[model samples]
Target chain A: MPPRIAQIRLVSSHPQVYAPCDDSFALVDALLADRTKLLDHHPSICMEIGSGSGYVITSLALILGSESKNAHYFATDLNPHATEVTRQTLEAHGVHAELLTTNIASGLEKRLSGMVDLMVINPPYVPTPEDEVGSSGLSSAWAGGENGRSVIDKILPVADNLLSEKGWLYMLFLADNDPLQICLQMRDKGFGAKIIVQRSTEEETLHVIKFWRDPDIQIEGNEAVSGGKTAPQRGFDFLRSQISRLSFRETRQ
Target chain B: MRLLTHNMLASNIKGVTNGFPLRIEPEKIIEKPVDFNPDFLKNMFSKIDWKALADASKIMGYAELPDEVPEQTVVESDEFLRKFHHALLEVHLEEGALVCPETGRRFPVNKGIPNMLLHEDEV
Candidate 1:
């Protein structure tokens, strides 16, 4: 039987392209963990931003299999080499994605707006000097610039723009990027977010957060007030309460 | 480029709006047979811009697709599915230029890859 996810042996690589790493594997695992729901969702247009070595997108296509045949796959990267490597990876697996070497889906936005049913990203989330972000070649793959929010911040709005009403976004984040804050920002845009998977490596805490449009949340945005505060402010309150709840659970454990 | 990909692409030159159905001036269009998978085709049908697909395919010199997308009833028809499959996935533009509908900018395709990068001034 063919592997459900990309076989590491068949995954193509480049010295300049970011290869499959812990974060990449985690992103695929998150998709695998959610595979049943994903297959049921029957996404029509699926895309990956910053495809890197194409492992995550290839895994996604393989996971969905021929079950969702109508689904079209797309992937974009700023580095030209990464796009080449991604093409090789997808071809090896007998899966294919329209690969573009461009900044985040720049040329794709207008036509793709509100059309992507599923979008996944493993962005450059490491906090670095603001100047380091979007640099040439391989460095651009990891440089997040200033709490790593620079690229993440830019991507959030674009994702919002491109996502269809039923679209879902899965993205990886680091602790330093203040993922909770990122959730609040998404909340303001009428998206509800949940951490799908969380892992702590020796140097970093990584979270794969999934965002979906919540009708209740969207309706509540205009009218939701908790103790005379808006939804965003309420998100902060919810954050504090959540942290406390986690600490309480830890203590009991 | 696959029609599926072309369906999602637009000419994003700084001020170009309405960049749909970029003209495919194919120097070479390779038809590679892939395994037939009807389930995938059915699901993708809803996402496809059928008008664009038909128009683009016609320009590429193969009008295998219908003028209008048949009803979902045709999903079970293997003949219909294969043509849809061929246009969507099999036909590949090994060498071509995707001309921006609005800006007239031509993005070159080399070795089956379309270069969408823009110049600094364009950005």
Candidate 2:
């Protein structure tokens, strides 16, 4: 017998934000995938931005246990309705999570700067032209605008602002969204970026990218810090190099 | 509110970057006795911000966190597991205040409920 699929109703004001077919199940799979990777590192602080239904954070909270490494999971979504659903789901699972309803990168500086150790994002990355910015334009969750970099443009600068030294940033982007540009942008911000995983479908492409420090700077052979810890001095030098390059670009622009 | 919630929140208002790990300034905190679920506790091990939770727990007057997370050998110990369980799930944020780190806006919690409501001016 095949495994039975559970039909769970996920009520969202922006239903168009998610894939129309079996979103709940897709969410579960995404959660599991995220969980496996997160558990592999077991980061001290984890933040999930654009947590659509709270599945990833809730599932992480449930499976990782409250005590293991004294972990805390924060899930944020722009939609309040989605946040409410996330809160309900965690409560039902007897798991705890902090749910925030706000726009991407808003208010985070005042609250979380220099504190987070890991960040995960699955933003709207499909390219949309400037003229199309309304309901008929495209899915706000999937459309990335013109060059397919609008949301990434917004998020990258924030990642630079919020990510702690030696912290890791993970994101998923579509092939149409210009992964190379995204990588270049992150690298320009002084973060070492690489595609950790990818899955291509007939109509779309998905790639998971991990952004961190240059491997040389990481603390080698240290399993506790996920391979190695990037020293602050090297990180500063990298940042300086990036700033110099930016200044050169500014001179040209 | 619990540090778990604090870890995930961000200021998402337009033009403000760096929304993450919302800061917590607890005016009042209460530890309500929640039924212990070890399975649930065990399952949540990976998702936590350990240092933040431990720091917050200490601030709230419960300081049993070991210097480092013990090896798997000690994970099954009843004493070790119980201490971990109480710190994470048992403590409740009954009444307090959560202030956004960036904007300094205050969201009050009355009766275990955090009123994250924003005014028209805020929106």
Candidate 3:
């Protein structure tokens, strides 16, 4: 028989904060496998929103450090307990990062606005009814409201405001969820969104979805960033030209 | 949650219908390194909906797939196996949201975690 996936005990002060489930772990592993290619080049500032136990972000920091040396990750979570856990995890891994406790797109807005090169967020997209409000503590960490877009709706506007012109935003969501709508929202806000990874299972258990975005509203050819220039800025220029080309096409049409 | 699981998850709330392929509105999408096991990939071949996986992968900015899938026999081909490996095993979404099609519900993924909670009215 195949070896059972070893469950890692999540060290958290509040037991309510759940560790990443199996599928989540697998998704994270797959995304981080090719860190260099995914970022498209080097990113100066990388931020992870709602970092749980810091498993994924810390791993990313380590990989980025080893590969790019100049890249730095700033991770945040609403829960102080979770943030502390992430700090400890980063310390244990010998990876350096700036950890903070803030609600989604809170006080850090000014600090991060238009300065981030890459922003990674895994917000609560699950739809929760008002009656289920009692389950708020842990649930709040994950609940997305009636339409599941509550947090997303709030975040997108902020993401639009905060993201550097060429910055990339990566996210994970369920397919059963309305990713297209979110895509439309991103596009409407002049951001380009794409589904970068997907996993399907025979088991009827829960599924996870992931998405990525950039402000340049155009798909880029593999303009690999090898020199000292930041990937986001390069991507921004490429995307702008592409968008202009599309507009030119539309006008001709 | 795995893309497999995301494909299966739906909001079966009282009045809502057509819940499939939950949307991902991730706050962060990180890709962590994982050990590649060919045997595991082979075993999962039969269970996957290749078209869906391919389409989704393209949406995520990976477009190195062939138009038609090779025969199951081709699993041994080094080239074919490499493509499959990258498609199914390597991509990751560190942050984002998943929205329901019928009810338009959203589920958040933070760090690398997804929250599948439903509301009382939703139930």
Clashes of each: 4, 35, 81
Q: Which parts of model 3 are misplaced by more than 4 Å?
A: A1-14, A130-136, A202-253, B1-123
Which 10 consecutive positions of candidate 1 chain A have the poorest summed lDDT? A242-251
* Per-prediction TM-score: 0.87, 0.58, 0.51
Model 1: colliding residue pairs: A69-B40, A70-B40, A70-B43, A70-B44
Candidate 1 chain B lDDT trough over 10 residues, lowest sum: B34-43
The residue-by-residue lDDT of candidate 2 on A1-253, one tens digit each, is 3211222343223453342233233334444455556566556567777666565565556555543445656766655556666666666666666665555646455556655677778776677885443232126556667767777778877776777776778787666676666665565455676555555455555667778755443343433344444564444555445444544544454
DockQ of each: 0.53, 0.16, 0.02
Q: Choose the strongest candidate by TM-score.
A: 1
State how far residue B49 of model 1 sits from its true place (Å).
3.7
C-alpha root-mean-square deviation, candidate 3: 22.2
lDDT: the better of candidates 1 and 3 = 1
Q: In model 2, how well does chain A match by TM-score?
A: 0.68
Q: Write the per-residue lDDT of candidate 3 for residues B1-123, one digit (tens) a residue.
A: 244333324444457555555555545444444345565456456545666566656655567766566687787677776666666655555467667767677666554434444456764
Q: What shift in Å separates residue A120 of candidate 1 from its native position after superposition?
A: 1.0
Q: Is the docking of candidate 3 incorrect, acceptable, medium or high quality?
A: incorrect
Please give, for residues B1-123, the per-residue lDDT of candidate 1 as tens digits: 777777777887887767787888899888777777787777677778899998888877779888987887775689988888888888888788999988889998766768888888888
